[model samples]
Target: MKPLDPRLLRYARGTRVYLAATVALGVVLAALIVAQATLLAHGITAVFLDGADVRTLTPTLIALATVVAGRAAVAWAQETVAVRSSAAVKSELRGRLLAHLVAVGPARGGDTGAVTTLITRGLDALDAYFARYLPQLVLAALVPAVVLARLLPADLTATMTIALTLPLIPIFMALVGLHTEAANHRQFRLLSRLSHHFLDVVAGLTTLKVFGRAGAQAATIRRISAEQRRLTMRTLRVAFLSSLVLELLATLSVALVAVGIGLRLVSGHLDLTTALLVLILAPEAYLPLRQVGAHYHASAEGLAAAEEAFAILETPVPARGAAPAPAGTIVFDDVVVRYRDRDALHLSATVEPGEIMALTGPSGCGKSTALDVLLGFVTPDHGRVTVGGVDLASVDPAAWRSTIAWVPQRPYLFAGSIRDNIALGRTPMHLPEPPTAFAHCFTGTVPDAPRPDVAAAARLAGAAGFIAGLPDGYDAALGDDGAGLSAGQRQRIALARAFLRDAPIVLLDEPTANLDTETAADVMAAIRRLAHGRTVIIAAHRPELIALADRIVDLAPQPVGAR
Candidate 1:
């Protein structure tokens, strides 16, 4: 990305304000720099050339001090604003990225480790872009013009010399930047791969140990880590080289301007004050440009990640309508879902309100795809789904989702108290007890307390018994994904959330697939109770769950060549 990519302004809100403020501060800073230079030159000339005493130069001394202070204040403010803006931009980008990922669903291929790194470490790289690169970019444009305007009236020769040579810095910067950007891109890709590989190995460490391959995997990790280190060193080398080139060009340009001013001073054609001012201000003109080059190298990785994030955000989402979904029967008429060249599901079915409907099929028969359709996560390629004669496509997705509750095969438990987990979707509340050490593992705020109706929902889901037996009842904190809880306990917590949601439609995807027999029986009982007076759809192969369905819809696997 360039110093200021248009996409940042387009995708992140409030960036325009930051840019405008930076420009305004740059202008103020330029004025202070010029004033300080003029005062310093005048004070030195008055004392040395005119033989003026301290009493005579006191006002000049005070004015110079004020100008210096003003410059410092402006620099501090610019830095403060840039830091805040970087934070805001990252927050906004992360929010949009997460929302887009959720909308796209997990069926859409994405590496978990890459996405995690992008939102965390990748976005953190933007700090250099906003704090250093963008502020200097503004100064690079404004300070030079302001300094040139001041110098032209004082000495046209010195002004022209600076104008002619200043372009060399940018020329060298651009050439070096081409190489730096490529190296940074490669480094970012390697970091993402390293994160993915390490996470995969860690997650499967138990399996690897069981198969006696953990040592081999450790060697593989070491190799990946070494490669990452090599790439990082390469990127750093390019960055340092670019900075060196920028510094050399800037120093050479300032030296040329200073030589011109010095020769004119010796010839008695230039006044001492003007020559001194020109010499001092000439270097200031090139400083911002050199700084811009330095910051660009630091921020390149963030720019690459931002580019990827923009691509994800720009992917088209299924169009949703404004109409609300009706609380009635849902009909799936010849619905078909295709992935690549294969049809995952091709079937027709109806699920009426207050009925338990079961979808049974072998693995890969699109049982989950059917549930996805109901959840509005997938759009069918052919046929349609309608509720009370209104097309599902025409109903607003958010509105439709608001009327349903869903439980996946593996229910995710956030790090929080038992009560907070049960009241996940409700109003935020203070936790009755402080979170445990394990709560620090997950991202996001854990409610300090639980919602008022958490106990009722827990009772309805048969979770109140175990929860009450805990030391702190609903306030007892659980680890990441409820690590401390039994599978049955976790499922009950999910059921409590569903009961609390009280939506008319309930969808479950193999809720009992991983539970022990006794636990599964308990979950089944909770499911039966929760399905009362609601439209329940279960995608399951287990006879216990299928037997409870008011009607069963068995799906057959598609033929090998079927479209």
Candidate 2:
């Protein structure tokens, strides 16, 4: 997918080493097969037909047993290594896929269902690839070539016949399974849809319950599950038929070798030992090829997953090189950002540092979009966003965001401890103060009064009372999206997070949206406290919030729908 996802090839690369060993080992293995076959042929000729004594047969029997034991030992080691490699690959690849998903952020929510399917279920299908398909692929390449070389000396006609039929096995596999790739893709798509639907239903379960529609929704879910089952069955049917066809083809080819040997014996052109050897070695030669075809079905799905992971992993990361932050005034010149295909006039404001500028607009206006553009989360299609007198395009987005603290209308709480999630923006764990490290993640440099700063930020946002009231205070656990807290509480916590940031510039988006009137007043006061001696911008619709602004620029409607 990205030429090769290193993780997918990790198992493949290990297998390649094992593969080389297997080839050298398989030569020893094929030699053992030939020796065992030869011993059996010689034993049959001497003991049964020639009426020879145990003296002639006993040594050959020991040699045959020895070869079988050797092959058994090699096979066991090979299989064990293959399984370990598969486990390693699965673990590493799964981690990489998850990391890729995390890196894509909320932008991927639209494709979350499909992406999750690839990571969880699709990647799981790769077990057979590394554990089986890879080995079979290796053996398929090696076994036949060695077997052919050995057989050519003893029974030229029979060996050539078997050689000709080998390609037929794969050809037949493809002919019967021509539509398999397409069907597998469709099945995966359905899997993504199914996962998306399940998540949607679970999230909206409370809503459905309140509407008294849970029963009808359950019926709909059942129907979707039934359809998914039907598609799964269809996919398996194709796999089964393909495997059956390969098996039958192999069996037929081996049967033909027997027939050819019989004719040779009747015509007095071949010996009994040679004929027996040919028959024994024929099926084992096709063994690897047959396994490869069977394992391909599972590998197809893994390949698909690898392809999806690549899309995210290869997505451009914000460049941090060249034309570093310039030493001049930051500027946003006639900047405009619109949601795709929507005509909404976003903010048009101009200000310098040591200023408290408030953004006030009706609901569904572009206040948030304006901040997003300045923060470089979204780019303006029509206007230039400049920082330090350099066009944003000329500088690194990552570096630009480093100089700002943005608290959004909604704050994401990761699935971990509050402290751990906050530490994400920090340099690393080894830093002197953990809370200070978190404070620096939003702003490049740590703020003064690490512990008290966190407490003060929380206090200003009216979160201090609840946080201090908790059993563990600052160490209290927060659920995903701060679930244990109410909507107003979450907003306050976000406000605290931003306040602790202490960047040169603070972009606040609807900071008081979900708060009660009393909490809003406390938050407004907190904002005033934090804004002193720093640049602060706010998006507000409430009168209490609007009153805090020094100047307000009202956006008038344009012919294009919204302005």
Candidate 3:
């Protein structure tokens, strides 16, 4: 990726504002540089050559100090704006990336660990890019020209020398940047792999210990970590080498201009003030370029990550329709879903309003695919789905989804109070017993405030009994994935959430997968209550659960070309 990739502007919001601000700041900084250098030169010459006393140089000293203060203020403002702009860009990119991931769905096969690392650490790397590199890039473009223009009036020979030697720094930078960019990209990829492997192993650590392969996995992790370390060192080495080259080139350029100014001063052809001014401005001419090269290495990783983010943003999302989904029946007319190199499902089914339908199939027989299609996550390769004679393709996805509630095989429970998990932080209208009321009634201790709708829904799902028995009642905090709750308890909570949703359609996937006989029975009772007055579709195999369905559709795996 280029040091300042154009794609960032396309993917991250507020980039143009940052660029414009950077340019304005760079111009201000350049003007300050010229003023400060001029003032300092005149002050020094007045004191040393013109034999001016301290009192005579007081005004020059004050003006130089003021110009110095102005330069400092400009630098401070530049940094403050850069920090804010970086934050805004990162926020915008993260939001867009997550939304796109949802739109594309799981069929896109994104790695969870990779995506997490990208959004968190990878995007953070952009701080260096925005806060340091981008501003330097703007300064490099503006400062050198401004400084050189000022030098031309002081000493033409020195200005000409600066112009001739300045090109070498960028020529060297371009060559070093090519190598640095490649090294940074490789390092980023390795970092992503390391993150993914670590997360995968940690998530399955229990399984590894059970199979007595934990020791082997530890060795694998060590090996991967060592490899990542080695690559990191190599990348750092290249970055250091690039920085060294740019520093050397800049120093040489400044030295050349200084030598020309000194020779002219010795020949009496140049005044002391002009020589001093040219000498001061000579280094300033190359300072921005050197800083740009230095910051480029720091920002290389972020640039690589930004490139990946843009690739995802550029992917086409499934087109959503404009019409609202109608009420009545959802018809899958000879629908077919094909995964690359394989056909996952083919079906002709109709789910009528206010009726329950069960989808039964063996593993890998596309039971889930059918559900995904219905949920608008996947599009059929052939035929179409319609609701009340209106094609699903003609119905807006968000509008269509608003009418349905879904419970997956494994319900995800975020770490929060029971009420927050159930309501997912949204305020519901229904009122029931408050958490304090439930606590007083069941545990004899008044606790936190309650979510009435959460309690009412839990009662309907038969989860209120367990929730009420807890020390904090509905106010209890649970760990990730409901660590303190049994599988049946979690299922009941999911059912309660579905009940609270009170949508026109409900879809359940293996609602009783990990439940015991008694718990399953309780969940089934809840399901029956939830199914009442709603169109329900269940992907289930349990006889009792299947029996509740008004109709059962069994799916079988079909060949690639099967009709």
Candidate 4:
């Protein structure tokens, strides 16, 4: 990302507020720096040349001390505020990124490991960006201008010299920064790859061991780690070299300004006080810019990661129609999806309201893909899907989805109590209004509204028996993705969400695939109950599930250019 990306301001509201504070503080700080230098130069020149008494200089000393204290306070405030602003910006970015990913769904969200790393370790690098680099960036703009303005009235020679040489530091900084930014990008990309590869290994460790490929995977991880280490060292080397260059340029620039002041002072064209003030303020002019160059490297990785985040944020969400969804038959008219240079799905089908329609096909024939289309997770490359003669794409996704209760082939359960899982974080429905005469006496709000019956939903999904057997019953918490529960139990919990939802349309993907005969029979019975008076679409391979459908539509694999 740029030092002050417009997109950052657009995405993180905290950034605009923080930057305003920083700039205001920076202006105050610049004034204090000039005042401190002025007081010191005047006091020293008076005592050294005019032999002024100590008592006469007491006010000058006090003023100088106050300026110094004010500068310190500003510095402390900048640091304190920067830390808080960093946290707020990171939190805002993280929250927005996660929300977007969830809205888009996993189908187009990109790699899980890369996204995980970006949100965690990757964005954490921005601490350096905010805490150190950003404040200096503001000072770089303010301090140089203020110092030069002060010097213009004191020593025109020194002021002109500073102005002429000051541009050199930034010119060189930009050149070196280009290289540093490229190096940081490479480093961040490698780190992302390493994280993704390691995640893949851990997730499939059991399968790898069964296939006798565990050792191979371990060796691959070591190779990637070594490459990452090499890149890190290379980036650090560039940072150190760049820092040295900036320091040398700044030191030489200040030396040049000092030399010019010394010559003018010796020539009797400048006073001791003016020369001293020029010497003091000359370094201040270069200090902020020099520090900016140094801190830029520290923040480069974070900036690179921010660029990636912006890319995700800027990606257009498939335009959700603002119109509310209409009720009636759902139609897929020659829906076509092109994925990875081939046709993933090409189908046309229709289901009348309240009908149970089964989509039967072999793996890769696009049964799940078709269901995904219905769920509004994937838009077709060609053709259209409609409900009641209104285009589905022209219906608000949220409104349309409110009518759907989907259970995927591998259902994901969060780490939460069974009751919360069944409820899916839904708040209680608003309570009915009381009689008008008693309204003024009532203060209870929606939080006091009656919660839905979680146990009833569980019973409807055939999950009540298993849930009751657990020690904590409804309060029992599961690990990530329902870790402690069996596959059948997890599947039933997902079904429970559907029952609770009571949506008009139900979409099930292989709901009974992995269950034992008895469990499958129970699940099928629940499915029958769920399908009553609902428009049901089932993606299935099993004959038992196919039997439950009023009619079957078989999907055949389409060629790359198939119409």
Predict model 1's lDDT versus the native.
0.83
TM-score of model number 4 = 0.86
TM-score each candidate. Answer: 0.83, 0.81, 0.85, 0.86
The alpha-carbon lDDT assigned to residue 486 of candidate 4 equals: 81
How do the candidates rank by lDDT, highest first? 4, 1, 3, 2
Per-residue alpha-carbon lDDT of candidate 3 for residues 27-46, written as tens digits (9 for 90 to 100): 99999999999998888888
The better candidate by lDDT, 2 or 3, is 3
Tens digits of per-residue lDDT, candidate 4, 95-138, equal: 89877876666577778678888999999998999998989999
Q: Point to the candidate with the largest lDDT.
A: 4
By summed lDDT, the worst window of 10 consecutive residues in model 3 runs over 429-438
Q: State the displacement of the C-alpha of residue 330, model 3, in Å, after optimal TM-score superposition.
A: 2.5
**Candidate 2 runs further than 4 Å off:** 1-28, 52-55, 91-110, 176-178, 200-223, 323-330, 334-349, 354-370, 379-382, 415-450, 512-532, 537-557, 560-563
lDDT of 2 by residue, 38-97 (tens): 778788888777998878777888888898899898788778877776676666666665
| Candidate that beats the other on TM-score, 1 or 3, i.e. the better one | 3
The 0-to-1 C-alpha lDDT of every candidate, in the order given, reads: 0.83, 0.68, 0.83, 0.85
Model 3, TM vs. native: 0.85
